[model samples]
Target chain A: MKQWMTLLNKELLEMTRNFKWIWVPIVFILIAVMEPITAYYMPQIIDSLGDLPDGAVIELPVPSAEEVLVASLSQYNTLGLLVIILSSMGIIAGERKSGVAGLILVKPVSYTAFVTAKWAGAMLLLWISYFIGYFVSWYYVGILFDTIPFIDFIQSFFIYGLWLSFVLTITVFFNSFLKSPGAVGFLSFAAVIVLIVISGTFSKWFEWSPAQLLSYASTFIMSGPISSDVWAAIILSVSGIIMLLGGSIAIFRRKELA
Target chain B: MSVVHVKNLKKNYQKHEVIKGIDFELMDKKCIALLGANGAGKTTTLQMLSGLMKPTNGEILFSGSREGDDFRHLIGYLPQHPVFYDWMTGREFLEYAGKLSGLSKKDSKKRTQELLELVGIEEAKNRRIGKYSGGMKQRLGIAQAIIHRPKLVILDEPVSALDPFGRREVLELMGRLKKETAILFSTHILNDAEEVCDEILFLHNGRLVESGTMEQLRDKHQQAKIDLEFKEDAARYADLFTALVKVQSHAIKRNKISFFVEDIELAKIGFLKVIAERNLPLVKFEISRTSLEEVFMKVVEK
Candidate 1:
């Protein structure tokens, strides 16, 4: 347990020194805050599109606060996912490449503790960054449009957080065995893309899939009381994360350091 | 006391064998050097002993420990090129290493300071490792390895990357450290292996070709010799020395003539007397112990 914390501290320290603590959240907040601001100013932006042929009358409907907020959240579906993956891609693999893993693994520390510490570190950053950007988005939605369902807002917060966690976990999972950070990112991005595409294509079948959790996140923003299928997707996503972490620890132990 | 006993250790990566069935014992509080050419499997053997890599077939028995025991805490390892997180301060990296080695929080901090001072990097403890020079980084690497004060400390080519001054600093530090703990280091530079190492193990082409104390290796492999310089090309006066003394053999190379003899004391006296009696112009005459390079050559050449 102590070894895990020491590693966790080291992991966070690396991110902090590189200003990852600042940029990762800023990226998420920008993606989160952009949708609401753009939606609120669309009419004026269109009007000011340089002499719009007098009475071009672009009849654009104003989206509801919940809709605008979900739009902001949807931005995370792609951009936020990428940010998480890209930021986390090198956490494990970089250590191995630079030979730091050899130093750390040679100690009395267990592989489970090492991998868990890394996962927990990334998860902490993910949660804090996601929460801060998300809170800012909520504040924006309240000011620009009607306030979103308060309780529903909280539920979707976790659902989306889990989805992002799913993405980060996948990246960390691949990094444990693979040596190249680029390859890890590519394979993880491919995995998430596959899930998104398959679930988007076969909604009825993949409703219990982890990808369904992302749609479920937006659903929680729109309404209350989710169906059993959404619950199934939630369980699957959580299980997938646990399994990935568990498998990463196992594979990490079997892999040689030098 | 033997710190660790390795028996018939062998490692194979698929079809290619790396360490072929070698046996050796590491004694407590002694410095041993693993001398080898690059690709002689020095690194592989050290890795296996450090528990970083498993031997495909062999037994590594730590003193008083059985199979399935968790003895990693008792071994400290520094790789050839240690990579530290650039952002971490010298003190932070050492403290982290200590904690990972199972030291308590208070103990880890205290040990970190002690190691920083011992490695002579205390003044730069606050500085990030990224800012350290090659020598300082190596000192830090050595510090981290012995943080837990393990029974055995394994270093792979500790000074091979440093400049001349850095190498001297590290070698001097190793000279101090050997008094407290057992150090097993690998180096291709025979001088390094000779300077600080009390025992030497030579790995040549994936086998334990030779290993012994410095004196034992020197006596067994080397024939004491006398070198003569006559101010001019000594090779021109080869016959004058051969007739003066019945050496086992005589050879001329460059400006000096060498008499290879089993008995260096008698050979030295005879050569000196012949030079004085003949009124020969002798600029230098000296009896020399065989260099580790010579012993290393004899072992690896085979």
Candidate 2:
């Protein structure tokens, strides 16, 4: 436990030194704030562009707070996920490539501790950035549209957070063996995209898939109630994260740090 | 007492075996040089001993520990090229290493400071490792390797990548470090093996071809040899020296010839008579014992 904490501190320090703490949250906030602002001013933006015919009456329906929040999540699902994946793709692979893994692994430290510390550090960053982005989007939704209930908002936030955690866990797992950060990011993103596509196309079959957590989150926010499948999806995603972490440690132990 | 004992240790990567069943023991409080040419499995052996790599077959017994026991805490290792977190300062990196080695917070900090001073990098303790010079980085590497005060420290070609000044600094530091804990370092440089090591383990083609105390190995393999340097072309004299009846073997390079002799006295007399009679352009002639380089070459060739 002590060793894990020490390694965790080191990982956090690395993140801070890399300015991940500053820029990641800044990007998240910017993406989140853009959602409601764009939705609220679409007519004005379109009017200022003068692309329509002269004196043409434009009928644009105002989106609800829930719809705005969902739109923000969809934006995060693309751009936000890309940023998170890119930032963390190098966490394990870079250390191994740089030969730092050999230096640390030679000590009495357990592989489990080393891997868990990395996961925890990435999760911490994810939570901070996700919450800040979600809450800021919620605040903008309240100003532009109707206010969402706090209970429903928090529940939706956690379910979406589970999806982010699952993505990061996959990144860490691939990073354990892959040498190139770009390859890890590309493969992991491809995996996530496939999961999202499968879940959307075959919702009846993948209702309990971990990928459904995002849809469940958006559903909970828009309707204030989730089906039994949401609970199943949460359980699956959480277990998947744990298994990925364990698999990373197991593979890392057998890997030759050359 | 031996700190580490290996019996027929072997590591095979697929069909090609890197370590072909080599065995040696590391004695307490002694510095052992693992001498080998490149591609000779020195790093592979060190990695297996440090628990970074697993041996395919054979046993590594740590002192007072069973076969399956975890002995990593009792050993410290420095790779050939030690990489660090560039964002971390020297002090923070050492502290992190110390903590990883099971040192407590206070103990880690204290040892970190002491090691910074011991390795002669106290002034750069707060400087990030990215800004450090090669010598300072090596010093920090050495400092981190011994921060836990393990029973044994393994260094893989510790000075092979450094400049002369940096090499001298690390060698001198290794001299001091051996007093506190046993050290097993691998180097291709025979002079480095001779300068600080008490014992030498020479590896060739994945086998322990020769190993003994520096004096013991020298005495065991020592041969009477003569070195002759000519002012003009020495190849001109190579044929005459090779024809001498007492000359067992001869190696020539540029303007110098080293002749290994069956009988030093007879060979010296005949060579001197030829030099006097012919008045060859001789610049230097000396009789001396065989050097470690010759022994290494002879062993590797065999």
**What is the docking quality class of candidate 2?**
medium
Compose the digit string of candidate 1's lDDT tens values, residues B1-302: 99999999999999999989999999999999999999999999999998888889988999989965777888889999888988899999999999999899999999999888988999999998999987888899999999998899999999999999889888998888888888999999998888999999999989999999998987798877788777777776787667755677877877777787777777777777778788888888878766789778877887
Pairs of colliding residues, candidate 1: none
lDDT of 1 by residue, A1-258 (tens): 778888888889888999999999999899999999999999888777777776566888889888888888788998999999999999989999999889988889898988888999999999999999998999998998888767878888998888889899999899999999999999999999999999999898888988878678877887856777988888898999999999998998889888
lDDT of candidate 2 over B122-181, digit per residue (tens): 999898899998778878888898999999999999999899988898999899988889
Of candidate 1 chain B, the 10-residue stretch with the lowest lDDT total is B239-248
DockQ of each: 0.81, 0.78
Highest DockQ, which number?
A: 1
Off by over 4 Å in 2: B231-245, B252-256, B262-281
Whole-model alpha-carbon lDDT for candidate 2: 0.91
